[model samples]
Target: MIAFLTSCQEELDLDNPNAFSLEELLQTADGFELLAVGVMDSYQKIPANEFLLIDLRSDDSRANAQNGVYPDVDAYNMDTNNGDAATYWSNNYATIFRANSIIDNRFLAPEEYQYTIGEAYFFRALCHFNLVRAYRNVPYLDKVIDINSNEASNYPQLPPSEVYEKIIQDFRTSIAFLNGGPQNRYRPSEGAAICLLAKAFLSQPNPNYTEAELLLASVIENKESFGYDLLTIDRDDAVNFLFDADPNDPTVNVLTTEEYRANQAITFAKIFGNEFTGEFSSDNLRLDGTFSNNEGLEINEEIIFSIPYEAINTDNVASSQSGLDDQVETDAEGFSNAMTASGPSNGVNVATLDLLSLMTPELQPVRFDGTFRSITVIADDILNDTFNSKYHLLGKPMGTIGLF
Candidate 1:
């Protein structure tokens, strides 16, 4: 009885050295926000592999080389155990797990931290939705798996419909809590929730066009309040899109700044603007005065949700920062020096000849641009941005949003 009483008085309060107390971290002032930022940052790491699956499968692109996992994904011969499949699956789920942690302990956060919790829900919902779409029947993990608890081995591999239900549920939670504009363009807002919810509603089994329509309308009507707008180009500020050996040639037929600045002309030129021109006079990037008044760039208004890269140039500058993105942070001093050091190109996956003719002069939906899909900067080098078209299914879910 004495020994038992002595044992009862002892307490063990040892801190974990090998594991992070993510729950405790969530309770800190900036911890919830960092959790949100980490989720967003992880998204940036996915584009490379994500592009491979969507792009190479399409008629537009082919394997860069016959080696590595490229050929496997290119030919649709990827097994579940394949390197590419495993990599993509692992990366996405990592983000999902982080989100699950935030959601599992909702009470730990104060009422003031709703926005942080909302972002987690939004990210979690998005991660699950994409996994359902890509992997079909996948293991939907609601909470972090306990290795010692046998839960890891017995995860529920449910159908995509069930997955959709999970996604919609999380989205409802996100919409309820995700208020304010955004922490940044990368972060989700109420409008982001609405946009994604509409997409989710449209993607379900029977589909819910009415609900999708209403949600999309709410986002579209109040987009300005959410900090979204169409970008404009001034006729005087537009750059000439021609490879004229002789600048003096008058009769030579070439597209000019005047034509590109017109309401009807394609805005595709924005992708291949003078960001690579090492000169201070270049970088027609309008991003809140990152460059000098002489540089001509004013700011970017059209981009609603583009991931940003660092402006401090290392090996990767704006051009080297893969496929398509803006330097959302305005530290252009490194950018200018990086440009001057190496006049690198922003080239990406090559498009098919047929595909080029398709989107060259202007963008899609004939109501928007009937003529050209792109402008010829040089004979063979028509400037273009490589958006994965195989992900057309992604756009297909937006059936009503585009029309409205």
Candidate 2:
């Protein structure tokens, strides 16, 4: 019986043909590309709690008094126990770990994948940049920390100055490795690296204004080569909608209400693209409608880099309170509640009174209307009016979009 059991154990010890070691998998360009994609996937979580840390503390925005978690943030009294702060810290480090994997193993990859290494450096720098800015003294993690070793202790929290130095160096390396323009706006590029480097220079303890200026100038001078430009609308073409009056006629000095709306609609389409609706109706009334949850103005030349999100079904959205030991699902395919929350009463982030005072239709006609809409509520014979920012709109799961 003992000899038979020994033979069975020996048979089970044979290598599983289906399994591949990390070393074997990473011996090709495709493997490096896969790692780079993993880095991006990790980065998708970094922005999840940014609104709580940055916007809520700023004067332009505030937290809903109703949302218990963020009122401390809005009051500038958030503590170490804050969940949002903890989440932000973890998300950044998670992204850094994935990025470091590609960066540390770059030499093993083919020369053709150097651009992917550059992207890894860019992501690593970005994570550290955000960390130092938010937490001041933070560990500048360049390589993945081993769980069984003293690697974590080797990277003690460094001063903001030292952290900035590492961030700047990583950005410089990224710029050197990245070549040409961006093939995909969703990915990093040489231009993106240069811009980020310039921003880092300005953001550090001692701002290097001269270097930043030169870098920005180079970007502006070579904007066409980088495939970047402001989205523009032809004024003459817009004026042609003026009541069918000769657009070239000098006597047509005034625009009728319908003509004015048509001109505004033209401008809106140019900026937001035709994917958006609900601007104006046949009766010249503004309708409440959701923007298309697809790649619309996101592809505009003005966009430098943007994180993309799909409009996933509400049922697929992950719960925030899943068990720690269990696999905590994330809304990786959809927008977070920060941008898609229903309204001021139910949402955590909202425009402050100070910002709302300046966002009136009279003060900012096109800009205000495009970004915000007002809603009034009545309770107990009292009327309450609130201006819901575009981010607060319901059924809109559009992800974060960044413009130059």
Candidate 3:
């Protein structure tokens, strides 16, 4: 009986190195979900250079804070050959690597894993979309790489248009493969692929707005499936709902009560009085309503997707310790909460002024009572708007945008 049992176990195919049968993984889950996770992970794992490119080019984060090696508080024209160029060139390649790895691997999953294939298509397309946007030209590898002869270095860059063709195809395939389910949401659902497809087409210098319009329409129609929408709550109301109000005596150099109250009465309210209520605050209504307090903002019925910050993989603080030459010149430990948290514990890295300026729009809802007296010289009303505007862009007016 023992011999029979042992033989049965051996015949069960339980010891395959590939989790599922080699044939099942290739046929079942495929590589979609793996690729999707890779695309998502790339955003968080971006290096300082790539971060600079996106942040500098982005609308609000350009003027105030930054993490670049150089602190250019002023509006200096960026040359593609300068530091900005290096950032653009490096980050897109990294994204490509993640996408490529999945395409080249065997995704082992049970035959029942149908959604897996859809996710892989979505991620590969997402990576290409981002790459084409940043680099203008990138390699489009549809087939698995040959381990024997072909190396990454041997691969050549394709024209941006060619890359776009592959990107569009991947997204469309993703939409078709995914049968619209919530399980897909945690990964890059059809919704994310559609969003990416629309973005990819739009980024073209001479875009086909008709196609873009159609894609966006699909996004709206199936919005509920993917869970994308705006939060209706006032910024302050949402904050109150999310955090516990543990009003501690203001930190040693914190804003004074009189100042806090006066500022709170203005158009904006103070952000510090209320503590985190276990809700994520990453995508607040700052710039285009995408900015948030914590790395992952969870506003009411809104939020299509939110990326959680992993402390270890997060961009590191190069200069938090005293006497570090590269540390930001701020007398205060750190300016932004992200920097502040990293500074004392790990190390602090300042967000670039270029990113601050790029993300800054003309209007926003801000925490009023939380003014930095040390940073602003003007009246609260004038500075209030500036403060709110800056915060909305994920920055602080510790120094004027023009200070650069």
Residues 1-404 of candidate 2 have per-residue lDDT tens digits of: 99899879967877887765567669754888878877776776676576667766888666566778677788988777887789889989998988988888888878778888999999999989989988899998888788567877566899999999999999999988897635566788888888889999999999999999999898889888877776544545444332334478957654455445445644453343333454444363333354432334536676566554433244453212222232212442222444432333455546667877786555655555455434444421111334333431112223233343
34-65, model 3: which lDDT tens digit per residue?
A: 44455555533332343344443444333343
Model 2: worst 10 consecutive residues (lDDT sum): 319-328
Q: Which should have the higher lDDT, number 2 or number 3?
A: 2
Better of 1 and 2 by lDDT: 2
Q: What's model 3's overall lDDT? A: 0.44
Q: What lDDT tens digits, residue by residue, belong to model 1 across residues 1-404?
A: 99887786644436556544676676578777677677766654444355556555787655444346665676788876776566667767888877877788777777777787888888788877767777789987777777467778777799878889888988888888876645344467677677788889998886999999998777668866875555455565554544333367855544443334332233332221212212211234111111111112112333334443433223452222222353321222222222221221212243445565666434443211222222235533543433221111111111112221
What is the lDDT of every predicted structure here? 0.53, 0.65, 0.44
Please state the error at residue 220 of candidate 1 in Å. 1.8
Worst lDDT run of 10 residues, candidate 3, spans 395-404
Ranking by TM-score: 2, 1, 3
Give stretches of model 1 more than 4 Å off.
Answer: 1-20, 65-68, 181-183, 232-268, 271-299, 311-348, 360-378, 381-404
Measured against the true structure, the TM-scores of the candidates, in listed sequence, are: 0.65, 0.78, 0.54
Tell me which of candidates 1 and 3 scores higher on TM-score: 1
